[model samples]
Target: MSTAAAHPAVRTRSLGDRRRRTLAWVGVSLLVVLGVFVAGGVAGDAASTTALADRNLGPSAGHPFGTDPLGRDLLARVLAGLRLSLVVGTTAALVSAVIALVLASAAAVFGGVVDRVVSWLVDLFLALPHLVLLILLAFVFGGGTQAAVLAVALTHWPTLTRVLRGRAREIVTSDHVTVSRQLGHGRGWIARHHLAGHLTGHFLVGAVLLFPHAILHEAALSFLGLGVDPGEPSIGVLLAESMRYLSAGAWWLAVLPGLCLLVVVKLVDTIGENTRALLDPRSAHL
Candidate 1:
């Protein structure tokens, strides 16, 4: 082939390779996260088991993440924390996504009053300081796992709602959707068959993207004593408890677990980004 023809083939191959790598990274990141979630659950009791003899041990072959002041295995504790974080984050994200979906759908389909209300609500939420709003809601809800989930869910929906509303509005105006409306389809039927079907990609991508934020917020709430139960070794709780010991040179107490949390968050965020790229027709081929 001529150089020009060969250049196109090479570019196509490069794009294909890049796409595959992105998909692979997404899959691997997901598996690692899922593994941590499941492993932590399996090691539930071990995370809290105190071992006076092993107290404050640094990273060793047997205790890779070291031991906490209370002599609990740090790795086990971190795993448990991650599991709890995952549960809280996933629940909150799903709830937030559902809220977004419902409000966006209403705004797009009903328009006028409903649209105005949604727009106002989204603006109000966006205007608030996110973390402050979270803390306030969490405090009001009595500061527990449920509170954390609810607060995160309530606070995170506005952005997604706005995005989905725009998409939903476009979908509502599409030929098929208009035809459905003209064919005697009820609002509910049209929503389910047309809007919902079309908006699935946006819904999923938004939910996935919301997860890391949920996890971090949950951790922050716990750190502030407004998150999971005090006794649970959630990442935030672990970090909270490690504060006193940090001055004593046991850096692993806070650093290691915090790093793990960051890693998980990064992984989840990567998965979300890659998934979004794959789903987006604009970028999927590039």
Candidate 2:
């Protein structure tokens, strides 16, 4: 059946399927993320599949990606890393979005000293290098999973807030909004009834787009030793470890996890594209 002719649920599922496939890449990423912590806490510490005897061995049923110099199971490590990466990625994205929404909404609805203060803070954040600032914050704050999550989120909110603030500005000028004001509607009513409806689409699309950034930020931080701590199996951290084994001919240590990260980013980009097509009036025909 034609994509357009399929049942609505099926069509939605199709989109979901694509989204899931894309997210599968994220699943792999999260494995690396989880591996660090999971491996540290597991039995025999066998999380990494590559045994000492099997170090640098090529892909096989017993050791698909082969072992690293440290004799950890690379496959297990990669899987675990996926969980960690996802946790950090998802955590950063959610917290960042919440922060952006609260600040943006308050600034837009109140529009006084609050707006200026928030806008100024946003400008300050925007001026800093996001990844660098995140690393510094993570370093200063602490090294727990939650700390890493907050660090990433704090650095991320400025861009989203800027986007949403602009969107709200556009919405506040509309006729319905103006009429709501004239009709003696309260600030809450104007925000909930008129402003929110229009901004939802834009913000959601922005949120999806932010996913890849969040993932990358978390992975990067972990790699830099500022996010997930040692033994925390993030893909970025794994990639960092793999670099050590690269000179010894253990390629899968990096390749598999890196491939997963790349694919997730692309898939997220695709979803954002499709979402754009669906949400943008100008792109609806496409």
Residue by residue across 4-82, what tens digits does model 1's lDDT show?
A: 8799899889878888998999999999999998999998999989999989999999999999988999999999999
Off by over 4 Å in 1: 1-11, 281-286
Worst 10 residues of 2 by lDDT: 36-45
Error of 1 at 41 (Å): 1.7
Q: Write the per-residue lDDT of candidate 2 for residues 15-73, one digit (tens) a residue.
A: 77765665665566445444544653552346644456655666778767666666776
Q: Show where candidate 2 strays beyond 4 Å.
A: 1-50, 281-286
Q: Report the lDDT of model 2 for residue 107.
A: 88
TM-score of each: 0.95, 0.78
Worst 10 residues of 1 by lDDT: 277-286
